[model samples]
Target: MELFGTEGYVNVSVKKICDEAGLTQRYFYESFPDRVNLLAAVYQHCVDIARSATIAAATEVIDRAGVADGPVPAAVIPILAEEALGGFINSLVEDPRRARVILIEVVGVAPEIEKLRLGAIHDWADLIAGFASNGRPTTPKQKLAAIGLVGAITQLLVDWQMALTDPINEQAGPDLFQVDSVHEVVTEMFVATYDKIFG
Candidate 1:
């Protein structure tokens, strides 16, 4: 992760990775067939951490709000959304190398990697959709909207990490990388859109 995070996939070498791990190339080869394989493993690990944390955050909200016996409380939706978003955002912020590897460096790396990325996106979208609908069946429009929202958020974070969000380039007036402002805006947008889709 550190190697790929620092030098990126194209620039990273097996020697560097092994050196960083204080292991032999033989050991790396024993575990991973190639660099892409190593990248896949790292990506999967990071995704698992992120997914688990986000789910835990949502579960905490559900437990705290005491929504086990009935439909999720309407007021709890924003809290859940915020908590889930915070979990995901903090995980990336805590280890931006993982974020760059998953969000930026993995782009166009391999068909399998791209497929994995899309699959992860859809998995997250499914979770958001289910939560938005309060476990009710989602309409086609709602499902599509959920997917779109996921895509938007992913791109937003990607741009933020890549320094693509400058004041002149964005119509939002300020750089979107301002973490707190971005978090607040994203939460508001998500809550509003989720309600519109499922309310």
Candidate 2:
């Protein structure tokens, strides 16, 4: 995972991975058939981390709102969005290697890998849709709105990551790296979409 994040999956070889882990090729093959398999595993691991963080953060907000066992009020939607999205974003920002593997390295790796990535995105969208509906069955429109919100957040993170890599973005200021800024933007998007869909 670290290697894929720092050196990139395309550049890293099985030999390097084995060397880093002090394992022989025979042992490595025992676990994974090829490097692509390993990359998929690593990507899943990163997604799990981010997903867990998002859920946990949102749960905390719900608990604090005294709505753990009840429907979440519409008024709390913005705060929920801020903390939930912040959790997902901070989990990656705190570890750029994970961020790279997720947002950059995982792109166009292979058909199977891309499928896995898209599945993860849908999983996140489903999660948000559940939150919006308070665990009720979501309508197709709600699901679509949730997916759109997730896509927007994903693009925002991609752009933020790009700015971090480009020297010219340095002049854009520290807001690029601030989780608060990201949370605010995402929260507004979520709130507006929620109003349109569920009001």
Candidate 3:
């Protein structure tokens, strides 16, 4: 997983993967049937990491804001939005390898991973809907918009990652490496959109 995430899916060979882990090819085969299987494992691993991080962060916000048993206070929404987005974005930013795996490496890898990816997208959309509706039931249009929001977020992250690698984009400034600018803008957008849709 580490090898695939860092070196890229296509560039990582079984032998290289094994060597990176200081293991033999025999050990690799024993664990994973093949490279694609290893990739599937990596993809699932990243998804799990992302899910856990986002859930934990959101749960903290809910608990800390004392919204566990009653209606969430409007005052808590910005905090919730910022913390939740911070959780998701930091999960990727803190480890560029995981970002690479999620934002780049897993595309069209295999049927199994693709299935997981699609499911993850829906799950993220559900999360977004929760934010928009503030625990109220989401209308079909809201649900569709939630999905579109997730897609937009993904594209933004992809572009951000691309900028990190491209020399031309790097010339913009050092702030590009820091995600808070993007995070702040996203949080504001989310708050405004949520209020607009279900204010």
Candidate 4:
């Protein structure tokens, strides 16, 4: 996303990314079977970074709030929110063409990428579901909700792309870069859903 934005899907050869990353074609091929695999790896790497950042942020938040030893409160949703927003905005800031590639091209003619991307989402959902507050409803229910919420946020990115009624809408600002606003909004909804049924 930092180099190409969403349109990176079209004509975004691995050679280019490798060239930018200062690696050779042989190494690229050795690392990734194809572009799809490479794309998946990129997604995974970014998601992992976001997850770690989220956990650290959550840990800090809890510690600052002075609840270090107790049963960790339900936090997977907030973490996901932070990840989603950051992912979307950072991708845009890193590469305007990345969004096109990630949200659009990767899903087309690239089952491998889709597999990795969707699997990542499911993994996040699984984490969220598994880590809900104690005595919560069945895990399946939480997983289902998590999956839907993630999908909704993902679609929201696509929606923003569609809403841009310009030939070249690439003027995103620094405000979005600080936090994932879309995720921030959606996380509240999920939190409320959990509170209503489980609180």
Residues 1-199 of candidate 1 have per-residue lDDT tens digits of 8878767889989998988889999999999999998898988888898888888888888889988666787788899889988888888888888788778888889999999889988898899888888878888898888888888888778767766423435554435466665667778878999778777
**How close is every model to the real structure, measured as TM-score?**
0.90, 0.93, 0.86, 0.67
Q: Give the top-scoring candidate (TM-score).
A: 2
Error of 4 at 17 (Å): 3.5
Question: Model 2, poorest ten-residue lDDT window?
Answer: 166-175
lDDT of each candidate versus the true structure:
0.82, 0.88, 0.80, 0.58
lDDT of 3 by residue, 1-199 (tens): 6777667889988899888899999998999999988887777788788878887888899999877877667778778878888889989988889988888888888887788788889999898788658678999888887787778778767767767765345554445634677778778877776777756
lDDT of 2 by residue, 1-199 (tens): 8799998899999999999999999999999999999999999999999999999999999999999998899889889988898899889989999999999888999999999999988999999998989878899999899999999888778777766775245565445645567668888999999999956
The 10-residue segment of model 1 with minimum total lDDT is: 165-174
lDDT of 4 by residue, 89-163 (tens): 565445445455445556655766667778877876665554454434555666677788668766766655544
The residue ranges of model 1 lying beyond 4 angstroms of the native Cα positions read: 164-174
Task: Please identify model 2 stretches exceeding 4 Å from their true place.
Answer: 167-179
**Pairs in steric clash, model 2:** none
Judging by TM-score, tell me the better candidate of 1 and 4.
1
Instruction: Look at candidate 3 and tell me the lDDT of residue 178.
Output: 45
RMSD of each: 2.5, 1.9, 2.4, 5.2
